[model samples]
Each structure stands twice: as structure tokens, then as C-alpha cells.
Target: MGKWMRSAIQRQKQFYIQQLMQSGLVNDHERLEQWTMAELRREYERFNPAYNAEGGSRHGQTSPRTGEAHH
Candidate 1:
């Protein structure tokens, strides 16, 4: 990758790293540094409230508490 591309990726990774750390999903910065950007993003999104806010209906599943699909 070019210098700019690498710099961008590093910045994006830093964002995810901070998010993951704040979410308590990651404790070791060294291990996080070894992760690919895609991996970091996936982990961050997994715990991100907005990413999960779409609810189960959109994902083709029913809610466990109500046994009803979200709308």
C-alpha cells in the first residue's frame, strides 16, 4: 500500500482499538496491534450498540424475550 493508504488504515485501526478498549472487549494493546483492520472492525462492531440496534427482524430472527420479530 502507498504511504497515505497505510496511514489511513493505521488511523482507522487506532479508532477501533480505542473503541474496543473502552468496551472492555480488549485488554492487551499488543495483541490488538497484531490484528488486521478487518478483524478489529468486526470486534468493534460486535459490541457497538448502533450495530446491534437494527434488531432481530432485519436479521431474520425473533427476539428471545418477546418471541416476536422486531419491526
Candidate 2:
């Protein structure tokens, strides 16, 4: 059980690291690997355009059918 949990956590970290790299947030693999999962998630969300300042999805602000911001 412990091994499986550890593996899952590792996978999540790697996933976030890959996303950060793809988003041009981090350039060094070694440095990224040194960061904790929480740090990785924080940084990832900080750069995510869909998230508002309160960390809520911005989708609600847009009209579902038109895909335009609600005025």
C-alpha cells in the first residue's frame, strides 16, 4: 500500500513538472525535481490562465454557448 501511494505521488509530481516545462515556467529538470509537489502545484496554478485570483475556474465567467466573457 505504501509503495503504491509513493508511486502515485511521484507520478503526480512528474506530471506537474512536465506541465510546467511545457508552459515555459521551468527550464531545468534538476531544479524542478528538487521542488516538492505542493510547490509544483502552486507554480502550475499560478500560470494557468483558466484560474482566477481566487483559484476558481474562470469558465463560469464565460457564456457556455458563445464562449465569450459575460458582461
Candidate 3:
């Protein structure tokens, strides 16, 4: 996930979103610096609650990701 997720799309939009991010169309450069796979998984959860980052939940908001890293 990114720091400021100003926008979120459905899972079907993943491909287009990635293309936009990589092409600078998303405009979240700062987020890229501190981005992590774990965070990405969390964002995925917002789309699919059953989604798991590490085979389990990070307790919704207790993870370090809930700090200033959020948008």
C-alpha cells in the first residue's frame, strides 16, 4: 500500500492502476520510497477482507502501517 491512497480501485483495476503508478500517472512518489509488500497486502484486504498478507491479519490497524504512513 501507499502512504496516501488518495484513490482505490477494485481488484479488476489492479492492472490499470499498476500501469498508472509505474507511468507516473498516479503521482505518489513519496509513497514509493517507504512502500512494502506487507502494506500492499493490506490495501488488498480493503478490496478483499479474506486477503492475507502473511497467512493472517495484521489486526486491521495495529500494524506499524497504521501510523503516519496512512493517507
By TM-score, the best candidate is 1
TM-score of each: 0.73, 0.70, 0.28
Report, for every candidate in turn, its global Cα lDDT versus the true structure.
0.71, 0.72, 0.44
lDDT tens readout by residue for model 1, 1-71: 89999999899999999998887756898888888888787666555677777532245344332254533
Query: What TM-score would you give candidate 2 relative to the actual structure?
Result: 0.70
- Sorted by TM-score (best first), the order is 1, 2, 3
> Distance from true position, residue 41, model 1, in Å?
0.7
Model 3 lDDT tens row, 1-71? 66345344333345434643654423564553355545554554533434444445343444344353321
For TM-score, candidate 1 versus 2, the one ahead is 1
- Estimate candidate 2's RMSD in Å: 10.2
